[model samples]
Target: MSDINISKLDAASADFDRKLQKLLAWNEADDRHIQQTVLDIIADVRTKGDKAVIDYTNRFDQRHISAAGELELPGEILKSAWESLPAEQAQALQIAAKRIRAYAERQKIESWQYTEVDGTLLGQKITPLDRAGLYVPGGKAAYPSSVLMNAVPAKVAGVGELIMVVPAPKGETNQLVLAAAYLAGVDRAFAVGGAQAIAALAYGTETIPAVAKIVGPGNIYVATAKKFVFGRVGIDMIAGPSEILIICDGGTNADWIAMDLFSQAEHDENAQAILISQDESFLKAVEQSIHKLLPQMERARIISASLSARGALIKVNNLNEAVDIANIIAPEHLELSVEDPEILGKNIRHAGAIFMGRYTAEVIGDYCAGPNHVLPTSGTARFSSPLGVYDFQKRSSLINCSQTGAETLGKTASLLARGESLTAHARSAEYRLKA
Candidate 1:
């Protein structure tokens, strides 16, 4: 507890913005080595296809495979994994999947067209991508929740196929992930990972089919690979460290707030957890609660490091000030732990996911809360959104001009084209113009 040192900040501080900037700043440097390595891997996969994926999987993941055929897990394997789970685990997975599916069902977009006054039709055609690739981090980092979050929404969007790639380091696989693939209706899965898996998905291999888009979280190498392959394939987003910002009115249990901070901090040393409050005494109480409860946490060391390095206990003038700061920070997870959260939530403009009221813990949103846990991080909530069914679906502008409408539109197009000095465009439109 003595070594646990979380920063304390006041909204009235003279250098508050500077201190906040220092705290929130995450250095995302593009290392030449990593980019070059990813490029080489992409080139290899592009040229050699399945052989490259096999070779990299064997070398990086400590596997011995004579053929790429062994890389893909059969549908029977996924089914068997789901069936082999204990009753309790299976029930929990099903519950979470059901809730996620139900939430996603409401987000499905429908194509619609409307006739204009001039007998012209204008609307949008909504269509789902043919295939989407999901990358799940393997080893100890494997998250069954990630599989459910990414796969369920894509399935709900009516994507033709959901392909999954998970790295099974040292030939070890997690049954929970496989079971999730089964429950979430993953069409195919491969036990290959890192930059190689991303390249294979983006460009296609003999064994693994190419996908239109890729989604899910990964390590730095995987993130870089996603960045490199963006134009070739659609990606969810370049995710950053997980974060949580809580606004409390000194009413909720100090212990609960402290534990909530620990929840995100325990994710990793770089993860951030911040608490904002109007009551100075409540801030002190929460700090004491953090000191008292952190020792009992399983990931105490990690939480301590994260809190000490990035965590903050902020004292604001009032709850409104707290929301102002939250909007500026644009945290991935924002909790309004106040008496009336709905009122405060109205003022909140930016947040990946908002947890309302004292009873709503941010952890619930990560699991079965019926909203996407795959949210934009690193202040991306200011513009980006949570991964949803809409991500898998695309919109194409629809335009059906009647003969009368064409004549009028073509004349305008001809005038505009000629003004831009494009003779071919002008002539093409002029040809359609009637007299």
Candidate 2:
């Protein structure tokens, strides 16, 4: 194999920031045409109900189902899928499910209230969504991990019903995905996908029930449809390609670093894996290690393409410089593979998920590290976060005013209402005050 020539940049260079910006820029404008297509599909589902879902499933997934009822899988099928799994696979699934559930349990929100001296009760009441739609990528690439990540949290949040949609191209379905659904406590599983599936979930068909929110990752069409139906139904996030930014202090193994970079790159041609270090020699060594290891990877072509297109081997004056650059990028995954990762991690302000220390491989976090792998990407870690039980829960403010409390608060409310020229509101407050 030829030597991989990923982009090289020095943090001290004058044009470093400009070059970095260019690298980070993803052209979302090019997909404007998909919006109209998604809107049309959403309208079709809304109008024709189950019939539209059937038509789209038949056309896109090459299925022969004539009735919408056929799209919904039986609960027994999900249970059987779990039962038929090999012992190792089932054990792994159970282990991962247990860990994920344990973590999600910690994130569950509880209702709370307190009464004030004036007998005014104000607090928050927490409740889970009535139903949630989980989209799992099906077809050739099955993400059983995704099913676990998206479903377990909703279940932990006490969501009443969970509906899952996965594309079964040519009437084929993935058993592991099905098993995952069973293990995650999904109420219903459907063999449908793409923008049509999202639309059906957003706007309830006769067969498929509308959900309060939708959460999962999919192709651009699925993402576009999610964006269009966002107001009608909540979506977890409009995710971008996977990303990982590793900061090494020239202390870890070069081969380990190379494999870590390859982990995200093998995800797709657009996925990014960058390594930052203060030791220029270490960077060169890691690049050599990448060249040696790329030939052995199963997805070498994809890894090569991603590395060539978006991956980088960056050099900085010191570890502090690396942290500063990391904050600017706000990667989906940041690995502090340093001597004292905990100390270095204190400075990290952004990153969807941080894999601290050299021993914590990012792959573990993707599967069984007890955290949701559904993370923000394309530099969105600057604001967003990883998926959790909180996403499936809602908080409603509680306000109960006693007679004395109402009269005491009424004067302030009247003043504010009158200041805003809301005479009706002022009069309403005045009426409460007098009574």
Candidate 3:
């Protein structure tokens, strides 16, 4: 394979900030045409319901379904798919599901209340959504791991039901995805996808139930549809291309670091993979390894394009400088491949998920490592987080006041409301006050 020209940067460069911002920039701006198309699809689904979903599925996925009933996959089919998987695949799926579920269990929020001296009960009631929808990219691209990552969390959160939708283009369905869904406790599965599936999940077709929240990843159309349906139903996030930033201390194997960068770059042409190291020679060694390994990759072209477009290798003065750069970039996956990762991790202020130590490859976190692989991307990690059980739960403030407590709080409320010129609010508070 020819040498790949990944970007090289120095923290001490005179225009380092300018160059860094350029590398980190990703435009997720809405396209007017796509937005209009998604709006039209959503409107159609809302108006025609089952017929619209069926029509869209048939047209988009090349399926010849005569009825909406045919769109819903039977539970028995999912079970059979799980039963039919190869022993190795089945065991791997089980392991991954178990790990994901165990991690999700810890993230579950419970209802709690505390009584104050005035006999006023104030706390929070954590409740799961009634139902959630999971969208897995289907057809030629299969992601069984996505099923486990998304469904496991909602199930752990005690979401009443979990519905999944995947498009089977050309009447082709991925058995692994079906098997994973069955294992992950998906209550329902549908053979439909794209913006139409998002529409069905958001508005509820005759055959599909409206989900309280939607989670998982999808293509551009699906993402745009999610944006359009935000007010109608809760959404996990509008994810950007996969990203990984590795801060290494020149000690780990260069080949390992190269492969780690390859993992995210292989996701798509736009995916970003970056490495920052205080040792300049280590960065060169990884670059050499990248060239050596590129030819062996099945998705070499995609990886190469990704690395050329957005990937980088940076020279930092020290680990502290690396941490500073990492916070600014706020990548979806941050790897501290150093001797003392825990110490370095303490200074990290941003990142969707942090993979600590030389042995903790970011890929482990993608599957059986127990953390949700679905993460905020395009520097959004500064503000957002990974998909977890908390994403599936809703919190309601709990307030119960005794008569005396009400009287005491009412005076403050009445004064505040009256000052704000909300007469009805002030009057309501006055009614609760002792006469």
lDDT of the structure predicted as candidate 1: 0.95
In candidate 3, which residue ranges exceed 4 Å CA deviation?
1-3
Per residue, candidate 2 scores C-alpha lDDT tens digits across 130-183 of 999999988999899999999999999999999999999999999999999999
Scanning candidate 2 in windows of ten residues, the lowest lDDT window is 24-33
Model 1, 1-435: lDDT tens digits are: 347899999999999999999999998786999899999999999999999998998899999988988999889999999999999999999999999999999999999999978899999999999999999999988699999999999999999999999999988999999999999999999999999999999999999999999999999999999999999999999998899999999999999999999999999999999999999999999999998898898999999999999999999999999999999999999999999999999999999999999999999999898999999899999999999999999999999998888888999998999899998998997787777
**TM-scores for candidates 1 onward, in order:** 0.99, 0.98, 0.98
Candidate 3 residue-wise lDDT, 87-170, digit = tens: 999999999999999888898888999999989999999998999999999988999999999999999999999999999998
User: What is residue 224's positional error in candidate 3, in angstroms?
Assistant: 0.3
For candidate 1, the per-residue lDDT at 167 reads 96
Backbone-clash count (model 3): 0
Q: What TM value does model 3 have?
A: 0.98
Please give me the total number of clashing residue pairs in predicted model 1.
Answer: 0
TM-score of predicted structure 1: 0.99
lDDT value, residue 51 of candidate 1: 92
